[model samples]
Target: MTSPRRFDDRTDAGERLGEALRDRDVDADIVLAIPRGGLPVGRAVADALGVPLDIVVASKIGAPGNPEYAIGAVAADGAVWRNERAFERGGVDEEYFQREREREAEKARQKAERYRSGRSEPDLSGKTVAVVDDGIATGSTVRACLAMLAATDAERIVLAVPVGPPETIAELREAVDDVVCLRTPSSFGGVGRFYDRFDQVSDADAMSYLKTDP
Candidate 1:
């Protein structure tokens, strides 16, 4: 088995990703992170690129009995990405999916509202946007986010992550204009395994990063 490259933490991973984006000359107008884990990484990327920091909220639609197994995901604006194969494999019907989609979409909307704290949503009309995430696991959430972005008038959309499995990254490529993944190891496990300090970030701590004062 191949050894996975480890990052000191989300901040370290973000720095590496930011450097990669800069090296590739990725010009972005705004950095929308998927919190609460993505905030630290987003802060680093936004600072490096001199862009405003924001968030793109989404929620997973887990399997009927197994909440951890994501069958799909829903975004704040009701955009969705359904894993047809997983849904078929889990024998999930359209009725159940519709119910969960509405529930999860509302949750995503509320989360986005809370994160924005009364700020108006950014106008992505004819601008390049980067959606930042700590890493990709199943990619259900990120896929949903990309779908939401697709509905906007944004000129381009980029999905940026520190690490993700090669296959999943390949699948994601079809959903966005560009993908900036720092590492795609062959012998992939969970995202936490590649990080030395993968602690659960608190909402308060995550919100602090959104502040402009530093």
Candidate 2:
């Protein structure tokens, strides 16, 4: 078993986690990171593992009045993570959900274009893929990503993150072949709370990481 992760920055966290994963397994073809914040961490992982890295862009559909409240989230290719509990709690109808999905789907497409335009998505058929992220919060977005990757004919999929809530990590275990999170705190409030310098990753920084030869 690997030791718990503690780092000064995302690059440090990614390098440490990547080394752990590389020491355990050596058959990953592509390390796909969920853009904006995930890119830098992914770059470090890709560099350490000597693997190709790419983006898996997705966006969440927040409720109208409660913008932070997620009803559903969609990937670039329309894979949806419907929160049934949120529907029950928020009292959202199908029409509202559908409309929000459409809006978020468009945003996802635009973001995908910004992240990876002109470049075709990497072919995952019969290849192992490591999905990297800075961290996971409620896990809605990662679930959407797992669903999207499930449509492809990949040999295996690994979901790797720096940290997440214990319940979210448990929920993710059933979604991917392996879950590689170093920290699953019981009192996890948010991803940013764990990092020392967790700043909002800008589009330029994100795109730069994507373009880097990691």
Candidate 3:
């Protein structure tokens, strides 16, 4: 067996993810990618599956003082996923959680508007959907997005990522109908660590991916 390792870039990871999905005969009516990073991967996957690509927006609700530390995440439609353990550990109270959830949820809505550029969101009712991202760490954002999707009438919700820690992948499995993960390295550091050129994906670049077919 080939040893697990890093990818050349998000595109490479996307291709591998697409191939994995195909190998498993995953079906999807549409592909919804987490913006800014997931678009590249989503593009490849959507193209491979012969489906239209769309964006699913969510924002991390950081802890009270440490903005980079996520205590939870909220999707555009106000659906949320909170880490109860993290909240207790971080000493996050309900008031603060509610405040952050409201703020982040608004941000997610604005982000979705910006990405769509006034286009209506694709109807997901009764359709099989694949949610793609470059990778995951705590998976707070993906969890929030999946929670939101779960409330919808979609027939299936599949979470696809190129790499993540073993534990993170396991936790995510419970939140979706299926998960297609290419690599789950034990020595997982972060998503960028599994890519050779894991740079910040610019909004313009991400938007371009959405505009292009496949």
Full-model lDDT for every candidate: 0.90, 0.85, 0.90
Rank by TM-score, descending? 3, 1, 2
**Window of ten residues with lowest summed lDDT in model 2:** 1-10
Q: Select the stronger candidate by TM-score from 2 and 3.
A: 3
Candidate 3, after superposition: displacement of residue 183 in Å?
0.5
> 1-214 in candidate 2: lDDT tens per residue?
3345456688987997798788778468989999888988999999998888898877888776887977778998899999889877757889988888888888888888877857878899999999999999988888888899999999999988889888888888999899888888888889888888898899988889877762
TM-score of 2: 0.95
Off by over 4 Å in 3: 1-4
Off by over 4 Å in 1: 1-5
Whole-structure CA lDDT of model 3: 0.90
Off by over 4 Å in 2: 1-5
The estimated TM-scores of all candidates read 0.95, 0.95, 0.96
> Residue 91 CA error for candidate 2 (Å)?
1.5
**What's the true lDDT of residue 57 in model 3?**
91
